[model samples]
Target: MSENSINSARRAALGKFGLGLATIAATGTGNLASAETTPTSPHPVVLDRFDHIVLTVADVERTCEFYVRAIGVKVETFGSGRKALVFGRQKFNLHQLGREIVPHAHRPTPGSVDLCIIASTTVDDVIKHLKAVNVVITEGPVQRTGAMGPIRSVYFRDPDENLIEISNYL
Candidate 1:
């Protein structure tokens, strides 16, 4: 077959295989190795295998929408009877804002509620995504020690002004 025919056949094969143009081109050029089936990580170290993280929000539906629409997290369940909103990797419980729990005087203080979510993505990406969604970030993607080890973290608040931390290891 002519070179054009060979190239066209390869292109069709790659398209059917769901490979990107870059991956197809690299394979065609023979510069990429077969061993490199997937992209390589710089560290390649395994992070924590956490099952879930939970947060308390004032409005479960609003909080659930924020996560699903903005943060790209899929909602697993909406509360039936005071249960939390369970998303892809996290769960959030909606604590009703009332006169007893959230007294008129206690509405202005810090430490009322706080939560942090750790992800595989970088700290910068998390900050950018949150900022895009108008989520006010208060702290850094700074490195810190946790139960697992060191991690990169940023702090922010939900609609209820509850402190939240989003983190991943550097």
Candidate 2:
């Protein structure tokens, strides 16, 4: 898509969901898409250590398995019956109700946001480990420029279409 088209779409989306975007940003819950890089509203900020990240999945069980066995997270369902998985100190909760979520059908929008997984071990070790487990690796064990400058990392995907980036910032 052209730059103008992208900008127009983002502006339209932001206008439509301005309140929701504000809520997410205020809570430090997730990333929000915006146009023109406008300054966000100055709400009282209550920053806390991130506890979990949530994603909607079509099949909760399938997502559970991929995260538990493939990506190596501890999977569990709460007494309230909510399913969640944790990997590398990050927790991800999967909800089946997302099908009713607005813009739901347009799910898995690639390039929306990249989820970075920090590792203390070498990136190569992670690549080898995933390969040994027969996990499909879509990309990289190469150096890429990051916010902190260049770093080595590997990229892959989970069953629910989340981009997973593993990097050792050494």
Number of the top-ranking candidate, with lDDT as the measure? 2
C-alpha lDDT score of every prediction, in listed order: 0.55, 0.62
C-alpha RMSD (angstroms) for model 2: 9.5
Clashing pairs in 1: none
Off by over 4 Å in 1: 1-56, 78-83, 98-111
Q: What is the TM-score of each candidate against the true structure?
A: 0.52, 0.60
lDDT of 2 at 159: 68
Predicted candidate 2 versus true structure: per-residue lDDT over 17-82, tens digit per residue:
453334443444444343224444444442323577667767888878776665578987774787
Lowest lDDT block of 10, candidate 2: 30-39
Model 1 agreement with the true structure over 23-106: per-residue lDDT tens digits: 323343322334245543344542222344334455667876776654576556443544455544345544554412332343
